[model samples]
Target: MAHASSTHDPNVYFVPHSSKWPFFGSIALFVMMIGVASWLNEASWGKPVFFVGVALTLAVLFMWFGDVIRESVRGNYNRQVDVSFRMGMVWFIFSEVMFFAAFFGALFYARQFALPWLAGEGDGAATHSLLWQGFSSGWPNNGPAAVGGAFQTIPAWGLPLLNTLILLTSGSTVTAAHHALKAGHRKQLLLWLGITVLLGCVFLFFQAEEYIHAYRELNLTLGSGIYGSTFFMLTGFHGLHVTLGTIMLAIIWLRCLKGHFDRDNHFAFEAVAWYWHFVDVVWLALFLFVYVL
Candidate 1:
C-alpha cells in the first residue's frame, strides 16, 4: 500500500504495476458487444444476455474507476501525468466531436441532397423529374414509395424547447460549480454541481416522456424513414452522452464529499466539467438541427 502511494520526484514519472482491471474490463466489453449483436439480430435470448453484459460492464467500470480514484487520492500521480491526462481528455473530446459531426452530416445530407434525389421536389415548379413519381421531396420524407408510412414530427416548441433550456441552465450551474471549486468553496461547489446533476436527470426524464409520446401518439419510430431514422439516431446518441456525463458528475460529487480535491488539484472535477459542457454544447446543436430546424 505504501508502495502504491509513492509520489516520486517531480521530474520522474510515476509508473504503475500490472493490474487485472484492463483484462476484466475487456472481457466485460466483449460480452456486451456480443449481446448487442445478438439483440440486433432479434435472438430470443438476446435481451437477457445483453442485460447481463451491461451489468458486467458497469461493475468493471465501477471497480476500475475506484482503483483510479484510490490511486489519485493516494498521491500517486504527478504534474507530467496530469498533463498527459489532460491531453488524452482533449483528444477524447475531439473524437467525440467528430462522432457527432458524422451524425449531423448524415442529417444534413438527408435533408439537402437525399431529399432532392428521391423522386422530385414540390418547392417551386419542380426541381427535378420524378424517378418514382408520387413521392414528393420534402423535409419529412419517408422513402421512395412512402414505404416508411405516415408519421408525425414532434413539435419544437414543447419538450425539446424545455430540454434546451434545461441543458443550458445545467451548463451554467456546472460553470458556477467550477468557479466555486477554484475559489475553495466546497459548499457552493456541491450545491451548484448537485443542481447540475439534477438538471441532467430532468432533461433525460423529459426526453423519455417525449419519446414515449412520439412512439405511442405520433407514430414516430426508428423505422419511420429518413426523417425518423436521422432524428432518433442523433437524439439517441446525445441522450447516451448525457447519461454518461451525468454519471461522471455524480462520481465527482461523491469525491467532493470525501474532500478529495483542493483548489489547485481537482482535475477529476475539471475533466467531468469539461465533459458536461461538451454535452451541453452538443445538445444545443442537436436541438437546432434535430428538433428546431
Candidate 2:
C-alpha cells in the first residue's frame, strides 16, 4: 500500500506513509549478532544462522534501496528533499568518523599509556614490579606472556603502499567520473567510474593477499597480543568499508548506464562520491598511522 507517488508537486515534500524494511532489517541484525557470538564460541548451528541472516539483510537492503531509486526516478524528490538527503549523508559519514576514532584511540592508549604502565613507568613502577616483574615495555610487546608467541609485522612499504596508491588512484578516477557526469559526457563517465570500480577491486585483492601473507608467513593474527589485535582490527574494518564502497560504485555504474541521473539532479551520485572520498581519506590516515608510523 505504501508505494511511491507518480505525481510530483514542487511546493510539497514527499513522505512515504509506511515501510516494513526497517523492522525486517532489525530482525536480521539481531539474528546475525546472535549467530556471530555463537559461531565465535564454535556452536554447531551458528554458521548457517549467520549466513541466513546475512542473506536476509542483503535482501532487505536491496528492496529498500530499490524503493528509493524508484521514488527518485519518479520525480518524487524536490530541492528540499535533496538538501535533507545531503544532511543525512553528512551525519552518516560523521558517525563513521567516530567509529574509526574509537579504534585509533584504543591503539594510542595501548602504545602510550598501557604498555608503559605495565613496564613500571611513573607510579606504575610498584604495580609492574609486583605483577609483571621482568616484562619489557615495547611498542609491539605481546605482554609479559607473549600472548600468541613471536610474530613478524608486515613491512609498510609493500602491499600497504600498493593499496594506498590504488585507493588514491580510485579517488581521482571517481572525481573524473563526477566531472564527466556533470559535463554530460556519458561515455567518459562510464569509463572513469568503471576504472574506479576496478581500482577498488584491486585494492581489496591486495589486502586479502596481505592478510594471507601475514597469517601464513608473519604469524601476525588477531590473537597475537595488543599489537596484532589492533593491526587486524584497523585494517580489517577498513577493508570491509572498501568492499561496501566498491559495491556502491558498481551500483551507481549500473544506474548511470540506465540514465537515472542528469547534470542538475544527481544527488545519488554525489552521495556515493562523498562516501568514497571519505573512505579514501580514512585509508590515508590508516596508512600514515597504522602502517607507516
Q: Per-prediction TM-score, please? A: 0.92, 0.95
- Which candidate gets the maximum lDDT versus the true structure? 2
The stretch of ten residues in a row with the least summed lDDT in candidate 1 is 1-10
| Collision pairs in model 2 | none
Residue 25's C-alpha lDDT in candidate 2?
97
After superposing candidate 1, which stretches have Cα over 4 Å from the reference? 1-7, 120-131
Candidate 1: lDDT over CA atoms?
0.84
Candidate 2: stretches off by over 4 Å: 1-9
lDDT of 2 by residue, 1-293 (tens): 11223355656888976999999999999888888779968899998899888888889989999989987887777776777888999999999999999999999999889889889998889988889998888767677779999999888899999999999999999999999999999999999999999999999999999999999998999889999889988999899899999998999999999998777778888888999999999999899888877
Candidate 2 global CA lDDT score: 0.88
Residue 131 lDDT (model 1): 51
Residue 81 displacement in candidate 1 (angstroms): 0.6
State candidate 2's TM-score.
0.95
